[model samples]
Target: MRHRSSASANRLPAPRKRFGQHFLTDTRVLDSIVEALGDLSGTTVVEIGPGRGALTDRLVARAARVVAIEVDRDLVQHLRARYADRPNVEIVEADVLTTTLADLAGGPYVLAGNVPYYITTPIIFHALELPRPERAVYLVQKEVAERMAAPPGDKTYGALSVNLQAVVNVEFLRKVLPGAFNPPPAVDSAVVRITPKAEAAIEPELEERYRSFVLAAFGLRRKQLVRVIRTVASLDAERALDVVTRCGLDPMARPETLTPVEFARLVRALYAAPSSR
Candidate 1:
């Protein structure tokens, strides 16, 4: 809950490993964060974890309004004081995951964050859970950023990669060195920009079914995907294998080997299959 001030010159404070706190102190890094948010001024924007309002100041100057969500109590107080005169900036103290994005940010909006590494995946999904956003700018672990932006053949591809890519186009803005923060972190970080696809990935009904199926397939990742289906699909293993073949997937294959499209195809096949239920 320690908040670093922008004016303080001393090496702000090292990241607290327990809280997953990493204070971004490098101006060059901050500049890139601002730049990546290209032409978002006319619209509303939300920033997660605006420690000391470094990015908040830049965002407020450009956007119609800036809503910043900070969980750290002391930091929220500091932000209120810093932006006391700026009516455009609304600061909220709450956990980003539990806060409904659309309710917190009404209408369409863009999101920015230096998310705690521990909850990166959940937070990303949390943001996407709301109405489609213009784009999301995230400062996440370099490896995670890579995973998020990973192409089909990369070993980094997983349920997360498939899930995110199915709904959005992801691009990495820059790979940040550990030194960019107040206390350098053990791992490198990267700035990634994700824009939700103009077309919904699938119809709402199909999308939920796909999400459920994908989650099941990846649930027992080490086991063959058919094993997961047998447990979750209500279909017997033999029947699930038949559906897997109808969907053009190898019943023995692992979830990582399947593409997002293949997963969607499997969901369609499962729906078509006669169910014992």
Candidate 2:
């Protein structure tokens, strides 16, 4: 005899752990996130990890073009099927890291997503550095959002904080409770807005060097800046001291104490020094 199906059995698909899927189900929160995009009229939006298309539905109505990139093959099919009639929406199955924004949408676009927590930092980096979206709005872990929006001296402030802020102006929109999601993540989530800096804080040519310098400084956070600089840049004691002095930072200051501007200044000063030459 055949058995009758229940709601669980008939449900589209359960959240997958590996994919870090947590579908945003709360309509109020969903509306707020879309509204935060401020004027989406005629704008192109590249949405990463559009699982179950919760935000996709809202985005399609506002954006002139909506390119939804999903890593999970199952969800890709689901999203495509769901929005099949919507001419404005295009769904693609691919890992966000390999996919370039230009390849997805040609014109200026905003990056939006409820990003996978495991790949949150990597996604943010990709969004800011290449194909460089005009603006990015994401639903990320509350702690991660705080770190990205953190100021110079906050406890959470470190490499991620400095790196992102050096490129974009970040804002923490608001906190989102776990109840807002279908699976309900263990921790709360928050929405963040990241706007690309009109002008790069560091010279475009020196971006790589600047990044290396910042990573080194934060690698040994407890040490004085001079010592951390010497270890990372392979500079001697005297050269490190000289570099610190040139940047006008106190010799005893720690890495966490320096702002992004200070970090850029130090990198430039070190590069210009004869010792570095």
Candidate 3:
């Protein structure tokens, strides 16, 4: 089994196309990503898609321990061999989406990754699920980084913006051009830091409802709040108007114009409405 695994690892390409692998090669960008996570002297870090171990090399040096999850079996084998001597580094051969970070780390951990562009959003929200990391630093598509950190009135603000902001403080760190990667992605990428709020804007019990409400509102973002509330909450037109008015929001206001706090208020008002009950 060991011999076969070694053979398989040798045959596979460094950056597999199917995995959407674009390995970060620029040392400066790599340093910037690591720096964004702050000091990791005694911290455990869960790194997603540690392709070719470029970032992992830096992580293992600084972090107390590094649990690097790689989906590719070939890369997993390669990584295990590369870091076999390093007791602090654990190469996990598992899908990051399926594996729980808390279970792998066995305690609190910081999340960092140069995530695949195609699955960036899913990977992020997946990580943000229960037992969230101490903080997360991701090298994601520039557009997505903008959306995550975008303000209420910004053009990039949408359901993603509201949902993420409701729980975490987002910082758009810096942008990386295509040349930074081995097989450069066509589009520019950016690094973003996500730190979960000490006091979430929405309570844990209400998170599901809050996410659903925000998605529903942005689903019909061009429409006025009155119509969106009426459609999504199954409230009558008059009741919808009343709900929006009571929430201190303009009935004619579009969803994009509302802040995360305003969205939470509107959702609570909708839930309280008699028709919604």
- What's the TM for model 3? 0.92
**lDDT (tens digit, per residue) of candidate 3 on 90-205:** 99988888998888989989999999999998898898888889999999999999999999889999999999999999999999999999899999999999999898877666
Which pairs of residues collide in model 1? none
Give per-residue CA lDDT, model 2, range 159-239, as digits (tens): 888888787899999999999998999998999998878876777666778887888788899999889888988989999
Root-mean-square deviation of candidate 2: 5.0
Residue 22 in candidate 2, Cα distance off native in Å: 0.6
RMSD, candidate 1, Å: 4.3
Off by over 4 Å in 2: 1-11, 272-277
lDDT of 1 by residue, 1-277 (tens): 1233444422323345676788887888887887888897687889988876677777887899889998877677778767766777799999888798777778888999998999998899888874767888999999999999887657888777888877888998899999988667899999999998776554445666777777777777778867877877888978988878877788888888887777777776776334411
lDDT of each: 0.79, 0.84, 0.88
Q: lDDT score, residue 30, model 1?
A: 82
Clashes of each: 0, 0, 0
lDDT of 2 at 142: 99
lDDT winner: 3
